[model samples]
Target: MATVEQNVSEFRGIIFLVRILFHADIYREALLSRLIILTLFSYFFQNDWSQAVTKFYRTPLLYERSYLNFLYLQNKFSSTKKYKKVTHCLFDLDGTILDSEIIYHKAIQKICERYGKTYTKKLQNQLYGVTDRQLSIGVVSALKLPISVDDFEKQMTELVQKNLTDSPFKEGAERLLWHLSTSKIPIALVTNSTDQAVQMHAKARPKLFSLFHHKVCITDPEVKRGKPEPDMYLLGAARFTPKANPTQCLVFEDSVVGVEAAVRAKMQVVMVPDYRIDKELTLKATIVLKSLLDLDPTLFGIPAFKDGVKRGS
Candidate 1:
């Protein structure tokens, strides 16, 4: 009996050792694979590995896949983190939440016409969701028009004020705003529009402005860089409570640039197409709805609807 027990103990110890070795082997391989990838990438992309590591660490990833991988690793093993609760909706005005696209185009059209430059569909599409400075710079570059940034900004501001005063809301915008307000889900206006433009548009249309008011996150020239830079969205995220994880907020946008910004911020987004800007927005947006009015309780995961009030009816 004693010899049999000794044999059994030896077998159990051997099994335990083997299991440990197996786990160690898997871990080692994973580490080695990552190292090999990093080494190869550094070698091909940069001549010096040490210099590459330093430069890479200092800068943000330029590729979407790499950024996604970084986010995955960040969320996987992080301790003492409270996930964000989805209580806020970040809206893009002009195009997404309101029907001010015509006003914007008209303003640009008038300016372009003054300079003997045409505002074509192709050009407008290229300008969607770009920063005010970027848009002005681009138009100036394209038309070879002699316009300073300051002068262009002032002119655009005047034109926007003149054109947007009576701008109408997009279908279902009022209802959406009323519902969101009643629900007490905080709504912040995140726009690439300058603060002056935001004020002008808001003054022209109070209903839209009121929905955004203390909740506004305007693209100020002062604080951070513009969209595609991730600064504005990061600022929005920072304004919320520490627990307001990017996952909790919903970004409503209408342009590819807007979608890219929200994606980098790790927020979910709904895209309302800017028909004028016919970019392939479906690729980046989480949900590409035909109209904002189409959004219902079911869309937001509010499952309290009775059969009588079926969604999309």
Candidate 2:
């Protein structure tokens, strides 16, 4: 005699075969008769005549239940979509469009070393997203240096400018910008960097930098406060030809402060943070991506790349 597991397996196999036959187009006209015969066979095998007929009847019902579930899932998922439409795009410069944060790190570290203090990673992480003045103050305080914030800022700026002369676009930056430009989407560069820093960056890559419809620097007269404050982003939006509604703008940022600024401006934000950033800090953004390279333009209602078009090609 077969074991209980073997019996169950055999019964399942028979039920599967019956289901297949019942649904076959060629056997459709004889399905009723075959079902009856299969019910009798089940009764003979189980030696429970009444229960066997009920079990066999439930088989078709079970298949019907499964089919209905499959349809429900298909319709449910098909109705869902992730991307939203935006009229304008705003991007932060350092660590977002440009790979300049590491240069800033080196500059600040060199300054800290001059004061016989070390620039710890903990301090760097804390200052990652702060504005220029805020960062200068933070660095001075963190190192317990006796220098004024202005002096520290001046020294760091000199060091950063030297290092930033040939800074490359961050991964995915050039491709996405070119796509948006080709598609005729309005784009702006909004950064907390000073006017001088922005000029230095533009000097390095004038052709690429000239693509923006506007560039809003932290020193712009209209910007009352630096990020984590909405002033800069709001100003950037107003500079557009038709003046975008905050909701109609999408901001790309790589800092928690920038994300917060965009959110406060009532714009949707996509954060592509550095690897050292804490994951929890990114939760406030509308979406977080690993890098600009992983961004799906279609998610923002922008045209997606053609299937065979390689990035940056």
Candidate 3:
């Protein structure tokens, strides 16, 4: 019953409302806007449902939802880990493989105690993943110990010799190593520990140490810098027979320094941190596991262990 001019004026008004509804942030408003869009659509075609059906893709609500969904999918895909074809595994030796962190703590505590100071939890957290020189400096400065870095190193070496550095493997470490070795996947040991420290551990478990393709200690002639710097990790990957791209190596670490080193190398890291470490600190890793036993190699596209058992099997 409306005149042509009147219908055109109403159509323009509908278009203005369509703009507001499409940009609406509230879901309720967006839903209401959808209804309004449908009503206006009906009005525009003079209730020609057949034509609307033919052009549903041109309708704003369906198109808007599709756009929103596309944005959601894109963001979701980006947030997930992209390393599915990991070819080599690199491990941190101290806390990640050996139960040597406790031994290091004990030796440092002895040095601090000699100066009428106690090694605090705060300090231990800082030492995690640090090099021996950094450890000496931190302990000396934090405890206000009356000793030079060299002196501290002297006492630490003496103390470490008395207490065994070749401590037992951490939970599930040996099993995981065996599985990887059996699967014929290359493995490397990357550590910020001194050469003497690594030899002690390797001496204690010659057979176990043999599983590694090679070991990279910070004292290696080729190492330029220690962890929290990517130097050691980069060297470890390069030592592989065929060599590995940084993106193709998967690192397993238990300290903030190790994880950060791996991340700086642009490699994916799985963290198995001590309970004392801040959960927030471990968040930088690709994934955080309570222990090596909790990891599933297949998650990184590595071979499944025998019998198809997932954890501690």
Cα lDDT computed for each candidate against the true fold: 0.62, 0.77, 0.77
List residue ranges in candidate 2 displaced over 4 A: 1-82, 307-313
TM-score of each: 0.64, 0.72, 0.72
Local accuracy of candidate 2 as per-residue lDDT tens digits, 3-37: 78756755664564455445434443244445556
**Model 2 worst lDDT run, 10 consecutive residues:** 67-76
For model 2 the local lDDT of residue 147 reads 97
116-158, model 3: which lDDT tens digit per residue? Answer: 9999988888777788888899889888888899999888888
Off by over 4 Å in 3: 1-82, 307-313
Question: Looking at model 3, which ten-residue stretch has the lowest summed lDDT?
Answer: 69-78
Count of residue pairs whose backbone atoms collide, per candidate: 1, 0, 0
Whichever of 2 and 3 has more lDDT, that candidate is: 2
Which structure is stronger by TM-score: 1 or 3?
Answer: 3
- Give residue 196's error in model 2 in angstroms: 1.0
Worst 10 residues of 1 by lDDT: 70-79
Q: What's the distance in Å from true for residue 228, model 3?
A: 1.1
The RMSD of every model to the true structure, in order and in angstroms, is 16.1, 17.9, 17.2
